[model samples]
Target chain A: MRAPSKELTIDEVLGRIESGMTVGIGGWGSRRKPMALVRAILRSDLTDLHIVSYAGPDVGLLLAGGKASKVTYAFATLDSIPLEPLFSQARVERAAEFREWDEGMFQTGLRAAAQRVSFLPMRAGLGSAVLENDPDLHTVRSPYDDQEELVAVPALNLDVALVHMNRADELGNGQYLGPDPYFDDLFCMAAREAYVSTEQIIDTAGLTVDASLQSLLLNRTMVTGVVETPNGAHFTDCTPTYGRDEKFQKAYATAAKTPEDWAAFHERFLSGDEAAYQAAVTAFREEAQA
Target chain B: MSDVTRSEYCAVAIADCFADDGEIMGSPMGLLPTLGARLAKNTTNPALMLTDGEARILRGTPPLGQSGDVTEGWMPFRLVLESVVPYGKRHVMMGATQIDRHGNQNISAIGPWEQPTRQLLGVRGAPGNTVNNRTSYWVPKHSARVVVEQVDIVSGIGRARAEAAGPAATKFHDVHRLVTNLGVFDFGGPGHTMRFVSVHPGVTVDEVREASGCEIHADGDVPETRTPTDGELVLIRELLDPTKLREREVPSS
Candidate 1:
């Protein structure tokens, strides 16, 4: 993996993503969501995309915009975060198809892909409304021949995984500051290409400081291309310099209660240049501080 | 015909679920999580929100708590699907060991429950998930410990500097409800502080007063929890069972 001769803006990297492409977004619930990339996508023309994520506002925006053609994930969620209107419309109208799996089973299915398996089996989908509605979810008989139960899920192998690491070395090796890997390793390994978005690209000398560091690396050989984007993760991302500001989130949750509201909120927050966003949010902070 | 196919069964079961009784804010606790899940949906992503001409209330199994029971250990069926896990669920009822007048929660550890100290489940998903997920809280015991000042460890997301230490920090997200042993509370006020919404039946105002740790917008005559609708009961029965143990089929006598 050679270093890029030139640096690029977050938007430059995102401009190349195509429609119908399977994308793996790095984040679990709300921690370390690739905010920069999500903002770029929100402002991009790639309206039809297939995404995979654990949960966050990034997925919420795409799903709301009708940009997401499909999504395969272990959870569709918001944590303490306000609701997303797009998901509501789909759920009620039955426009979006959901495949059911238990919490463990969802991880197992992704593991199957990371391990390059064709499918995974579990007793998660039983008695689920999703199981009743989704044709993609089917029952696989237990091989043990004891209690015949329904268990089956199609293996998810992604085209590319968009990951934002806390810090990454030039070689693409990275470290996360939060609890676990936040589903990035599995999502990346399961995909054909892994596109990393890092807060900062530092030297690799500090790699062995933590034991888990060695365990998380998926050799450069497996990674297709590395794109260095700073502040690439937003809202959901955890960058060391700036912590999650409650004032901002409360405001965002308040302002963006619906798609129309989100569009307006985005215009107020996401649509502007970084300077404007910084100024607006900083002004908001100042007001709260005062 | 399947039990759910019968509308009568569904309605009766839902009604029983929302009946307010002795088990903590038992009744409204039954109703609100489902309501939160549905209402929170319209609030989160407005673009896809549906205000269908008809006002319909979708009674979903709110993650934990079985159809006719109250407890943890079960997640709602809506969260099972991979796609649903990522984009479907926006809010959830969190269990708290401690809370504040503002809707903050703490589930880190316990003290003198039996021994002098109880090492509770260390904020398993509370740190990142609480803020990242739309979180409300239900504290079974209404006491000083359950309602406290600043918490020991802010595991869930918060507004001031939560998850701000950088990518590693995910302590602050949303803190919505604080349903105590006596009543229901909401935290959408200034600084997102918790406020009393309603109290359960059989709970006197003094009982609620004695139980709450912080200031509450107490209601003199709180109403009883509505009966759980049949649709909600069906959703709960077929989807999430709080104990995690699957329901057993009837045996022929």
Candidate 2:
């Protein structure tokens, strides 16, 4: 007997998420992200989201749209643009709660959650301000003779995990063609459910034909649903499929200077469906060339 | 030999950081440090491993902004965080938004951590990099605002903080040299405070003191920063950075 297909629409994926649920977004700072699903969440009435990510524009967008109430992240940057303007603005204004951890500690938290462990010990945040800033974190001493102490990074379990990939099948086996798979697999494993948005949905056999076998980052068992959304990681780089839209990203960064500018940008690019947003981006590119 | 620019001097000083770092990974963040790492790999430290800033380990040091011939190994982000970082087999030179006398660095926010006046990159990898591996800093422009008495946030663990963390944290926690445009500094002074090693050719000790917010020890006679050799100058100009991007970073006075 064969397994059942788990294909889903953008709306159906968003339907699974509720208010104040912890959501883990995969990708490292302005790389492949599930922007289409994020866009749908923006258009919907979901509020008070507890967003977790090795953040980029997704955190900025959620903060800008008032969708997230708190954010747990290692850093929030747009790569080219050093600081994400909206997220920066939110921090300056103290608009939302933030639980900032060290990069390795953040990864350990996810690993702990994936492994079904309460916490993991590491040396990343031992005497740094991360422990001082967040009072919740504690240190643990080893039971051995050496009795070394380390930071007890708690598990960052998630209600849902959203990720974007190069290719996936109807049965939700995700594959990445980029140079780095990042921590996308860890995010999926750490969550109660995982939905992957991919550039193309091909036959299961076709995934291994051209790509190396190691590129298959996510197995079908780990994934709950797969949505085929072409160019789903716009503004962020999707690697061999396409590079980041630098012009659009610059425009996005510039528009965050003021509320009036953001409002105008919202009217032009956002405040519409995925098709409308894509169409506006096309128009934006044509206008720039002209 | 042609006149060596301040940026070139800074690059050579950065290269000297890895002169004896045999087979460990060298991760340099910005343009100047990238050039320095490549220069070190090409000339002095051939065994120093470098990555393509994404995944693959370059077979040999390539020129700036171009992928080299091939990769010797694959070091993706997952492997980097899981295997490479924890193993303490890497030396990283990262940028600092602000640094203090004790070498506590900050690339997080300005003002209070609760509500920052200006938010920078939020403590990205500094904590892990400092605690888990050999770390250094590259400050392109040194000023009172950057070289502070105390950092707003301790993104990277400094000498004092490492001492507080006890023996286990101090084992791999080596906050080495800090290379700036004006001079090179290290935490070797009394009480492990920042100490001035040398000044750039045109720069003076008074100028460095005036620019710094913290007390930089210059007890003995200070020396001028070493200029690159004719061969090194050729490698820097014709091979490594043909585009002259280093000029944009540290412009000639």
Candidate 3:
């Protein structure tokens, strides 16, 4: 018998998201973020989300929509672009519960969760105020050595993980053609359920043509569902497939600077479905060309 | 006399931050430092590894934003963090919003932790990077505000604090240098205090002292930072950064 398909619509993936649950969005800052899934959540009435990400517009959108109750991230940047203004505003206003960490600590925490462990010991935050600020973090003495103090970082177990990739097979096997796969596989393993959205869906055999591409593939067993989302990581980068839309990103960044401009931008771009958003972008490009 | 710009002098100072550790990764954050690392790789330090701000480690400098960049091999984030960082085979030059006399740098926040006056990028990877690798700084503008008496928060642990954290943290706790537009500073003084190494061509020791928020150690007469060679200048201007992005950071005089 053939295996049951693990394919779902973007709305179905968004339906699984509930308020007050920890959600992990895969991608390094402003790169291959699960933007379609993010937009679905933005459109939905979901609130009080505890988000975990290397962060991009995913953090900013949730914070701006007043959907996030907490955010645990290493950084919130648009990479070569300006900083994510909404998230910056959230930090200034004390709008969310913060569990800030070094990038290594955050990555290790995910690895621990993937391994079904309670915590992972790391030396990253030992000498810094990171340990002082996070009261819950304790120093674990090495079993073998008496002279060592390693910070015990907790496992970041997630309810759902959202990731966008370069390609996927129908059975949820995903591949990234980009330079860095980052911690996407770890995020999938860390979460109870993982929904993968891809720019294209190829046959399973097509994934193996290049040995380099095989290294970028995510295992099907860990993926809960797959959604084919062409141009999914728009505005943000999706490298090797397509570059970041600089004009759109610039406009978005400019809009995020103030409330009035952000409101206008939200209506023009963000206040619609993915197709509508695409149409608006097409219209803008045409206007620019003309 | 040589035809060296202020930016080129700054680049050489940044490049000089790295030790002659053979075949080590040089991950410089901003534009000038990036160009500096590539400059060092081509001219002085052939073993210095460089990337085109991505995964593939470049064999030669490539024009920024252009295709056809030559790659030595791939060194993605996973490989770099797992192999390079853990083994102390990497040197990184990062930017700082605030750095103290003790070298504790802060890029996370501007004021109090609870109610920050300005919230910058949270301690991204500084903590891990500092404790695991040789880390340096590139301050475009060096002033009392940028180099504070004491950092509001320590994003990267300095010498004294790293030493106190015991053996594991201190094993790789090498805060090498701080390359600024005005001068080059290193932690070579007593108790690893911030010591002014050399001033830029136009900048003086008095000017550096006036700009510094705290008492920075300068034992004797400081000389000018080394001027870039003609070949090095050619690589910087032509190959590494054809757009002349370095000029924007510290304008050529």
Candidate 4:
């Protein structure tokens, strides 16, 4: 028998997420994030979320919107802009519980979850304040003769994982034509359910036509659903399709400076569906040219 | 020549860190460090491997902000975390928002860990980088604000912290070098306090002492930082940074 289609709408995917659930967001700091889904969550009534990510604007948006109760991350940056303004503001105010891990330890935690293990041993967090700050992290001695004690990075299990890609089929095979695949696949494997939003939803065979086999980063088994959303990763980069919308990002960053500024920005751009957001962006670009 | 810029001097000092690193990955963070790593590869350390700061390992050192014609291998973020760091075959020169006499570096926050008055980049990879392999630092502007008595938070392991973590942490922990606008420093003093190796030309030991919050261990008269050779200057000016972008980072004094 042929496989059943696992296509979903933005709202349908958001329906699967619950309040206080651990949601893993895929992408590495203003890269190919699933911004469309993130916006949907922002629009939803979902609150008290526990977010895990190599964070970008998604963390900022959730924090600003007062959706997240806690955030676990290695870093939160907008690449060109060193520190994300919204995240920075959140940190200053003590808005939420922040669990900062070493980059390698964050990756190891995801790997542990992906492997369905309780924890993984690594030396990334040792001799650093990462342990002292987190406090719950423990060290384990090797069973072998060397008997080295290493930090046991606990598994970062997720209730749901949301990722954005270049292309995916209806059966949920995702492909990325970009330079780095990042840890998107691990996020999916570590989650109970995984959703992918793509620029294009093509036939399964077309996934490998132009792109190399290695670009097929996610198999159907890893993805619970797929959504076709063009320009989904706007502001953040979607790569070959589009670079980061620097002007829009600058505007967003500037707006984050004051509450009134953020309110105006929300009304102008964010207080809408994906289509309206795209239209507002189009008008924003037109205004810039004029 | 005698007409060497502070950036050029800094680049040479940064290059000196990788002089003995035979075949390890030379991962540099900012403008000066990038130029230094490229300069090292071109002149002294030909075997040094360089990444495009993204995924691909470069075939040869390319100019700043441009990937060259060819690549050696694929080294995505996953492989870097899983293989490269664990393998202990990399030397990284990262930036420091705050550093102490003990060499504990912080890029996390300013006031406090829980509720910071200002939040910098959250520990990105400093903890892993310090413990897993050789780690250096590049501080463009050095002051008492930056060279603090103690970092607000320890993102990178220093000597005291490494020793406390025991042999497992100390085995590969080498806080190699620190190059700043004012001077070059290393954790080589008695009890591994930050030691002044060389002060930049026109900069005095007193200036470094006044600028730093913590005590600097200078045994005797500190030497002047070396000026780049004509060959290195040519490589820096022509091949590496023709746009003189390095000047923006560490403007000529």
- The numbered model that scores best in lDDT is 4
In candidate 3, chain A reaches a TM of 0.97
What does candidate 3's lDDT look like per residue over A1-290, in tens digits? Answer: 97778878888888888988899999988889989889888899899899999988889988988989999988789887747888888888888888788888888899999999999888788798788777877878888845677889899999999999998888989899888888899999999999999998888888878736545558898899999988889878998788888888888888988999999999998889989988988887788789
Q: Assess candidate 2 and give its lDDT.
A: 0.92
Residue pairs with clashing backbones, model 3: none
What are the lDDT figures for the candidates, one per model?
Answer: 0.52, 0.92, 0.85, 0.93
Clashing pairs in 4: none
**Predicted candidate 2 versus true structure: per-residue lDDT over A105-178, tens digit per residue:** 99999999999999999988877899999989999999999899989999999999999999999999999999
Q: List the candidate numbers ranked by DockQ, top first.
A: 4, 2, 3, 1
Q: What is the TM-score of chain B in candidate 4?
A: 0.98
TM-score of chain B of each: 0.51, 0.98, 0.94, 0.98
Off by over 4 Å in 1: A1-9, A89-101, A145-150, A209-219, A237-242, A258-261, A273-280, B1-253
TM-score of each: 0.52, 0.99, 0.96, 0.99
TM-score of 1: 0.52
Docking class of 1: incorrect
Model 2: lDDT of residue B153 = 92
Q: Which prediction has more favorable DockQ, 1 or 4? A: 4
Once fitted onto the true fold, the runs of candidate 3 whose alpha carbons sit more than 4 angstroms away are A210-216, B64-67
Residues B1-253, candidate 4, lDDT per residue (tens digit)? 5678888888898998898999989899988899999999998999999999988899798888777748899999998998998899999999999999999999988887989899999998999999889999999999999998899989998989988997789989999998999999999998999999999888999999999999999978899998888999999889999898899999876
